[model samples]
Target: MLIWRLQKRVLNFVHVPPPHCGVDIVDAIYKCLKECGLKNKVFTVSMDNASYNHSCLRFLREIFSRNRRLLCKGKLFHVRCCAHILNLLVQDGLGEIGHIIENVRESVKYINQYEARKQTFSKIVQQLQLGTKKLVIIDFPTRWNSTFQMLLCALKFKDVFPRFQGRKPNYDYLSTPEEWKNVEKVCEVLEVFNVVTNIIFDSDYPTSNFYLSEIYRVKEILNLKAMDESDFIRRMVGKMKGKFDKYWGECNLLMVVASVMDPRCKLRLAEMFFPKIYSEAETRNNIEQVRGDLYQLYMSM
Candidate 1:
């Protein structure tokens, strides 16, 4: 495991054993923090969405809650990894059109599997003068974002595929026009997720404040697509919305307060966005509640 000290610009890597139970994981973290003289100074721990990790965090929080010197009383101590949640959301959406994606996947695998086929594809690219030597990318089924990239790269060589198929009449996995259109639509949605993931995973900067705006943007985009005229897009986005709401409908208050703390946004941003996301009454109540949370945070500091 790795621990980062943002202010001091230090990163520490510690060796941990396998078969990590909740108690074992929490004990490792506690011992590491105590050794570094930061057990009481920790305010939050960010981890992926695994059941064991959740239990480990809960155990750690319980331990810290018994300590009198800990500030914030461990109220904001567990942050679910945003990138993992984004991956889950996109994966769920991909399931809506899994068969279409599998067709594309198989075609890519066929083209890249043999050296002779790759050579033939290269000749086609040269004959068409596509002006680049980029090859089709084969995506792993488990990685949805990689699949998006494979489709994106495949689209660039869309014109060459038909001619190549003509030369090899036995290859029948070529995508039809409608299938290509579906790929394009799926790429459009996944691209937004790709950009957000890149922004959040930047190692050089703090990204906590960006969570509110980025997630709000995703929710708005999904809502707009849910109203799309295309039945396929609407159905796909509906599934995505269900997964998104399952994880993010009730986001952590610390992230909300962090957004409000931004000087350019302040409370106005919350006031503007809450109404769009919540009911009239709930909007008013949530905004007031966030204000109270912010006040308490300031006083505690």
Candidate 2:
């Protein structure tokens, strides 16, 4: 397990025994913080959405709740990693059209795996004078961002594929025109998620304040795409929305406070978007709740 400080610098990489139960993780974390003399200074621990990690965080929160130095009474101490949540959202959407994606994957692999076929595709690219020098990229199934990137690069070779098909009579892996259209739609939707992931995962920057706005943007984009006329996009958005709601339906107060504290946003940001995201009564109540929480946080500090 790796611990990171406020400046995004690695504090420690602790080696723990295997089996990775919640108890094991909590013990590892506790020892690390104690050795570093930062046990009581810990405000939050960001982690991926693994069941074991959730349990580990709950255990840690229970410990921190008794510490006088900690704020929020440890309530906001377990932050679900935003990048991981974005990954889950994209992966859920991709599941709806797995066959189509697999066909594209196979087609990209067929072209890039053999020297002769790769050279043939290169010649086609040269003849067509495509702007990019990037060849077809095959994505790992586990990483949805890579899949988005693969579709993006493959879409650039759309015209070259038909010509390549004529040269290789046995090339049955070629994506059909409709499949290409679906890939295009998928790319458009995933692009938003990809951008947000990049922003959140920037190692050199503080991304906490940006989290609320980026998440709000993602929800807005998905909601708009959910209303699209195409059935494929609508269905995909339905699945994506389920994952989104599971993770983000209730905005985390820590993230809300972070955004509210940003000089660029502050409370105005919440006031401007609350009505669109919640009912009038809910928005009013949320604003009051956030105000109270913010006051509590300030008093604690």
Candidate 3:
């Protein structure tokens, strides 16, 4: 995919052969750029945080620099995929509640497998007078956001589940009362992630400046929930916070630069919020660094 002049489009669809290593990826990318006569026009590459991608960038930077086409010595050449990072964070949290998700997922699958079961579940929904028209969703294991949606939808029809279980007499995946309570709390926590994920994935506009603020909101949620009275919530949030720090504890320089460039934020956002995420001394140093980087980038351009 390529983004040029605010327009995004796929420039090549090369088939990567077995052992898609960094050299192979760079070969494919270089071939495409050469064919398009764009070898010297490239600015940056946005990719997921895969280890091989780092290798790919290193090779590409060397090639571009040898040709004297690398801007700012390729300091801003790699942009980590934000959506992918968000997925890792949520998946970390979900790992702590796998059993609860499995039970809900299995219950949904059982209900969806046969027409008779679907009809019976529908009838139970009617009898219980559940005020929702949404059905239980069977989420795939790979997509954590789908799991979030499945849990959110299932919670709406949670009362109908017991009624359906009573009729079947053989159903085994219905969550216990305490488990249901946990699911509700987890759903509340995941709602913020869901909303921010949507905002990040929005394709109608450029979202770079929006990232730092959304990420800050997520940190606030994790820190607040990590101190909750419920041991379950606290434990779950602890795992999530660990993952969050692994990826985002230190500010990503590119993201901070973008935030500083936004007229609305423009240093003030960093000044106002850095203290919340970092110690006073670190915040002061970080703000100064970002300010200096901003000026250096402008001068280089």
Instruction: Provide C-alpha RMSD values for all models, in order.
Output: 3.7, 3.6, 2.9
lDDT (Cα, 0-100) at 139 in candidate 3: 93
User: Can you list the residue pairs that collide in candidate 1?
Assistant: none
Candidate 2 has what TM-score? Answer: 0.93
Q: Which of the predicted structures, 1 or 2, would earn the higher lDDT when compared with the native?
A: 2
Please report how far candidate 2 places residue 172 from its true position, in Å. Answer: 0.8
Candidate-wise lDDT, in order: 0.81, 0.84, 0.84
Evaluated against the true structure, the overall lDDT of model 3 is: 0.84
Instruction: Please identify which of the two predictions, 1 or 3, would achieve the higher lDDT against the true structure.
Output: 3
Cα TM-score of candidate 3: 0.92
Model 1 lDDT, residue 173, Cα:
84
**Regions of candidate 1 where Cα sits further than 4 Å from its true position:** 1-19, 69-73
Query: Model 1 misses residue 87 by how many Å?
Result: 0.7
How far in Å is the alpha carbon of 179 misplaced in model 2? 1.5
